[model samples]
Target: MPSPSRVLKLIALLLDYPSPDVRAESLALHALIRTAELPEARRDGLAALLDALCQGDLLDVQERYDSLFERGRALSLLLFEHVHGESRDRGQAMVDLLERYSAAGLAIDANELPDYLPLYLEFLALGDAEAARQGLVEVAHILALLAQRLAQRESLYAQAFEALLALAGVAPELAGQCYQAQQEAVDDSLEALDRAWEETPVSFTDPAAGCPSASPRRQPAGVEQPLQWVAQPVPQTHPRATR
Candidate 1:
């Protein structure tokens, strides 16, 4: 197994958008990985990815990253997108995850969601090593599916997910199942991509139409009750933190 620190650093670097700085960082990470005593296959896989990132044209890397991650939802970096897409449950999950981060004293930017893969890795980096491994295991299926999809696209980024699976101890049979399930979930055709972007009518105006009923109904004049308020704790901010 790779060192915990190295694994965390590699994941963070892999998730970043390719740039001159990232290219430099990839080179540094590559050197570190070369010296580490990891399994030959695992080390080679990660090294190959780092090599591609370091050698590829920056514009090409940016375009490929956008096409694979930005345009395609199947290979999204947001962990919850695969688990709970645009559902009320996903919103609740985010709220709960944010609370967990707060409890752990991890501050995230207002614009970044809690389920973002990099942010999640940052959180793990701050915790116990065993706990971090367990956290990765919790989402092993997602990583496995993403790796398979990226490999099909011949993306070097797929190695990052493969490394994650190794660290998370995902079984080959289980990974296969996860990959098959995700494949069955979406149509990867050009027609499907076009259809996904087609505009639909807004339907939020009608209160009685399909929307959930509003909570805390107003009381009649005679039944009015005194209002109660509960103060919410503000999230701590860290401007200097890389994550």
Candidate 2:
């Protein structure tokens, strides 16, 4: 199988919280969209998102992201929330996911959870191509769900999920089954959010934590954590994805 595209890591970086680092690489990202293996339509959508990011002050971009993903559970970036909600099953699911990352030679950092979409994508980018494709297929329903939600709000972030679905090559017949089955009412209103996130997010990979890994061996200290996998751009250089 062909290896997964480095574009996966690029998308992960862009989907992450808005940072000046993104702005700094705007040119490279644009070049990537122009030359990536994605279909033209998908590339166009992603370009729109990148354009939106580079349009105005970084602060405005950051605020929009906060309003979209932070204030609501509907568009929350945590993948498991869409599947497991707040149920206890989510915790075990997270442990399983962490094991997958550890088995893949990753050691998590930044107290990030196992289910954060960006972190998940970075993990997939480093995996076997078939495995990465399967991983994207596994979550294609959630991608569809989020894409619909974001598009409904006229949010540009929908482009990112749409791009993911394209890469996943999800059969149209099965694409929306789980998404269409979501019948619960989400309460991510202003007041609900005010009471939410009262505590810090937990990170299972924190070496300080005693949570032991079942992997054959532990990742030795001082390694590339998450989000650092994106091959960066160099000035006046031809930009290419490393994978």
Candidate 3:
């Protein structure tokens, strides 16, 4: 067994190492911190450990993790060869902490996070549709806030829309009902806009009232002409329309 004083000294050294080098030292720190008998000692060591994790440089930032790992392991008995299993005490919690830490880091740049759809699709395969839907919605919300262009926003929206469609499949009638409700909402919005226009003074109406036939079309204040909306007749119903 390593001496308690030596372990405390090593912990201090580990805390001072650069962030990219932390992973290589994690197992050793965990072993030392767990073996320590004093609660204060353990607390201090774990706090340093968590800080190292949360503030670490990007996992693939330098694309030199393996090299850094070998170098750091050379200085301490980090036991890189040991196999951790689910039965190991605190193993699951440690794994969760690591994953959450990684996700939190990725989330810092709202737009740059990796494509999460593939992992989510895997989750859906396991029959966790609800969880998958929730994840997609969360991602969509993030993308909506970050997307600067219509193209990117549309891409992210499509993912959420597909998940929503999958959800709607579980309730077919509700899907149709929701579509009808959405259309009704749009119609109501247009009606309200028309009513508001009607309430405006006479001077506001002529500019809005001009038809395509109104020649040397009067340019209404703040309205651009050649007016963009030109009404065309709808063709009479025929077999060609069905085709």
Candidate 4:
């Protein structure tokens, strides 16, 4: 069976398509099969919904894109929820997705990202501390992304502040570094956003270079960076846990 992360990636891709017909049809098909629902009823309902939505003027393209993106995100999170507790190895795979994708440009939901908090803390306490640290890094990067995107929006700034606070609660030292980086980036983004607003908000026709949203590439084979950063010390809590 395909992993939950793979399935979610597929959902994210379908949602990112620029064409309405492509987006709506793919989503409807996914919902029908994923839910194991009655095909006829599902098809009829989806058809009506798509027809009504398609009748809108092409000028509303941005609205359609946002709606489809949000829907796909909701479905991906649902898939992650279903697989999170099924098996530790498999659950870790989804957690791996959370770690890698929550980067500076990827728009991850702040609320949804916290779902990994318990798993992250538990893993640090029980599994691999280095691995857990990696997860925290991803969360920090996501916060930075949010702060940059919401630099001038008061609501976004508030939400990003809360997210930073939550991250600090997890691993204070690491989160503090992330919060500082995000604050600096936010300041820069606001300056850019302000200039753009006076003229036209900047838009990009291509994905950011080296962005994780294009799919994470394989890491170079070697000792992990964090392992190099900190020496492995004798466990203070569970001296016996470290073999």
Query: Number of the top candidate by lDDT?
Result: 2
Ranking by TM-score: 2, 1, 4, 3
C-alpha local distance difference test of each model: 0.59, 0.64, 0.29, 0.31
lDDT by residue (32-51, candidate 4, tens digit) is 33443223443343344334
Which of the two candidates, 1 or 4, achieves a greater lDDT against the reference?
1
lDDT of 1 by residue, 197-233 (tens): 3412122223555432121223212212311111111
Q: How accurate is candidate 3 locally (lDDT)?
A: 0.29
Q: For candidate 4, what is the lDDT?
A: 0.31
Query: Which portions of model 4 miss their true places by more than 4 Å?
Result: 14-17, 24-55, 63-140, 147-243
Ranking by lDDT: 2, 1, 4, 3
Q: What value does the lDDT take at residue 224 in candidate 1?
A: 21
Steric clash pairs (candidate 2): none
Could you tell which candidate, 1 or 3, scores higher by TM-score? 1
Residue-level lDDT of model 3, residues 1-243, one tens digit each, is: 544333434432432223544566667665665555434533453545444454536564233322222221111111111111112333343334234434333222222111222222222222333433333232232222122121232322222222233332222232222111111121224455454223211111133543112112233222122112111111111110000
Kindly give the stretch of ten consecutive residues in candidate 3 with the minimal lDDT sum: 234-243
**Model 4 per-residue lDDT at 89:** 46
